[model samples]
Target: MTGGATVTGEGRTREPRDAVRARLVDVAVHLLRDRGPDAVTTRAVAAAAGVQAPTIYRLFGDKDGLLDAVAERAADDFVAAKAQAARAEAHRGADPVKDLRAAFWAQVEFGVANPEVFRLLGDPARVLRSGAAQAGRAVLQARVHRVALTGRLRVPEGRCVDMVQSAGTGVVQTLLATPVPDRDPHLVGAMWDALVAAVLVDGAGSADGSGAAEPTASATFVAFRALAPQLPGLTGAERALLVDWLARAETAAVQD
Candidate 1:
């Protein structure tokens, strides 16, 4: 146990491999939080975890891999909590706009509470490739779909999703940049209100029932298209065909 010396049966370790891996991640998280990102060197994490450096490479590939795993782990936990709360709210039949606003606040709180992991999750490359990132997006999309189903969403659901995510990220980053006392207390509420106004119709549902009650046929098509992927009992090919038809319908509606 001294300097990663083995205690084992026939070269197999006494502890489970997963336990060892979790120990390394925990040590790295502590280092990143306490000493900042620069202090989370492979050598440091390995030493702190009581494992040899090669174990770090074997378990995580390299430092970047290790960081990604750590980010994913943290994000998974955060998203799971959010998803659970959202499910609970769904059972209560919460207003879509109010639910979205509450989610935004949670995002802001998470960003502030775990700045290091938040920054890691913000990396474009990491976000693009990470399953954790995809899971988070799926949760947001589900929420947006609920809004669309209520005929409250005015723009395309994807557009609304992008807007919410971008605004949340920007607001959190700006607040993080400001000194604690100097940060504006009203910024989050103001931004959320603005985004909601921009993306939602004044009334729920479109009058003709084509689009969230908007006069535009294209808007309805957009909402329909957004929900295509979620249709249960549809094969991948069937979903694609549905999406294609919706896209064509949207184009035709726009031209009219």
Candidate 2:
């Protein structure tokens, strides 16, 4: 098979194989954005990329594979923007909590601005498995670990991570569900505060808040949830069952 081919689009010719793949992914993303997911058929993408249908299959395997590539590209862009913001925050000597808040705000803005791609990223299972998504999570975990290192985290490292992810995703999904003009502009800030209050100590990592909004029962379970992976003496099935219980406890913890 040829490693490179000339692919023309918009009166420009892409020469490298990677460049051709990128063009296809970009076209697929644009179609997915403006026309919805249904519009990103193989033929549509091939036409938009000025390539034969077989090229997409050769580069990405199939339609699902192409969508995965598109999702990864979107995730990479989001992660890159967040990383740049975090770096800028560091250079300015920003507070860790403030840095976290800024990062959260960036995520909110990204999700709100790219609702279609955000929808593709909303699946927890997919996020857990995607390399790009894992990179984003690592960034978040590093921030939360910094908070933990400060002794300001009211919950375990794992619980705080989960709470933060849940709140951010919940807020974006809620806003996206509302009509554009009808959406509440302040909802993101409110949810951020609530999430901070739920995980940080009084006057701790948060700019405004005390101990958790709920009791520590939920937080303790989260700590246990984090520990489940290392608990010894349990069979594989037992460990899985315990993890499931921990998950249920985590859900209940927020309700408290």
lDDT of every model, 2 decimals: 0.82, 0.78
True-structure lDDT of candidate 2: 0.78
In order of appearance, the predictions have TM-scores of 0.80, 0.74
Ten contiguous residues minimizing lDDT sum, candidate 1 = 204-213
Off-target runs (Cα >4 Å) in candidate 2 are 1-14, 205-256
Cα RMSD for predicted model 2:
7.2
Q: Candidate 1 — which residues are off by over 4 angstroms?
A: 1-13, 203-256
Tens digits of per-residue lDDT for model 1, 11-56: 6647767889889989988888788899999999999998899999
TM-score of 1: 0.80
The Cα error of candidate 1 at residue 119, in Å, is: 0.7
- Give lDDT tens digits, candidate 2, residues 1-256: 1356554656555579888899999999999999989999999999989989999999999998898888999999888877777667667866667678777887888888888899888866668668999888888887775555455556667767778878888888998899999999899889987887677655654554333333256545655665677789999999999989877876775566
Residue 166 in model 2: shift from native, Å?
A: 0.9
